[model samples]
Target: MSDALAYDVFAKTCPSRGTLEHVTGRWGGLILGALHEGTFRFNELRRRVDGVSEKMLSQTLHALERDGLVHRDAQPTNPPRVDYRLTPLGHEVAGQLLGLIRLVEGRMDRVLAAREAYDAEHEPVTGRTA
Candidate 1:
């Protein structure tokens, strides 16, 4: 790895932050996870991931495609159906993401318990409770 001099996350040239935002986007993780299962069309993606609007799905897919993580295939059928699948690079990234998700799931209960404990300790007793 080359030694970089500065860290300006807000700069347009800083891909690190943008990449994190892209991967953590609302539909991004789910889209990657869904694609991990197999290739699917736009409608199928929407169906698999609950509560995603068409606009959001389109935007997410476009973003992933631009990032070179997703491959879009458009067939010359009458209706012009398109399918989306993960590129090899996307597969590698998705595998890492899945590992992260699995780790979070495993520790979620402990994390929640810690949050609740902290909140209960910090919160002032209401007049009714007092």
Candidate 2:
């Protein structure tokens, strides 16, 4: 008889334990969602998203491309244009990703309210200033 294969996400030592964090990181999630509509030129993407530095964007793109989620195209043109798009696999992953986003958006108000209440209830009124 053949041995059964196994996998678990709970153990911190698991190789894939950090994968979810990587795929769902601040830049990764946003970049994937943005690329869903269509390919975007480097500068156009920079303008579309607020607060992402150019270097970070480049690095994020490189990571996604390495993971087979994003495709980078550099055209031989006068202006030297480069754009990014999602692979078919990326579409599947990104759709699941959007699900997480929708979940967050639906419950964000409650989450924020809870955080506010926690802060108000826990703040030291007359404790150490620093």
Candidate 3:
């Protein structure tokens, strides 16, 4: 057998957990999904993944880049230009995430109904709504 170490994401001590978190975290998934469309500048990516603060976006991008799921290209000009895109691995992962995203979006009606039913069943008699 090859000496390459295998990673199991479910293992408590495995490093894959951190990468998984970076890929699935609130901002990470959105960033990856946005980048899957095309390469984008920092500000453009920020706008694409709305509601993310500049600092948070920067941090998330750095984490994703470190995980080799993102490629950061810097160009030297009168003003520096930076673009972010997905690596091959990132593209594969992003495709999977997009599938999940689409599934959730397509089933929102059912999800909303389920939520309402759950709330109705669990709500207090006072009717203040939880």
Query: Using lDDT as the measure, which candidate wins?
Result: 3
Candidate 1 clashes between residue pairs 3 or more apart in a chain or in different chains: none
Summing lDDT over every window of 10 consecutive residues in candidate 1, give the lowest-scoring window: 1-10
Q: Give the Cα-based TM-score of candidate 2 against the true structure.
A: 0.83
Clashes of 1: 0
Candidate 2: Cα lDDT at 7 = 39
Model 1, range 65-91, lDDT digits (tens) per residue?
889889999999999999999999889
The TM-score, computed over Cα atoms with residue i paired to residue i, of candidate 1 is: 0.82
Report the C-alpha displacement of residue 98, candidate 1, in angstroms: 0.3
Choose 1 or 3, whichever is better by lDDT: 3
Model 2 has an lDDT value of: 0.83
Q: Tens digits of per-residue lDDT for model 2 on 39-116?
A: 899888887767789998998888888888899999999989898999998898889998988899999999999999
Superposed model 3: Cα runs more than 4 Å off: 1-5, 127-130
Model 2 regions lying over 4 Å from their true place: 1-19, 127-130
What are the lDDT scores of the predictions, listed in order? 0.87, 0.83, 0.95
**Which whole-number lDDT from 0 to 100 does residue 102 have in model 2?**
88
Model 2 alpha-carbon miss at residue 126, Å: 1.2
lDDT of 3 by residue, 1-130 (tens): 2432687778899888999999999899999999999999999999999899999999999999999999999999769999999999999999999999999999999999999999999987775665
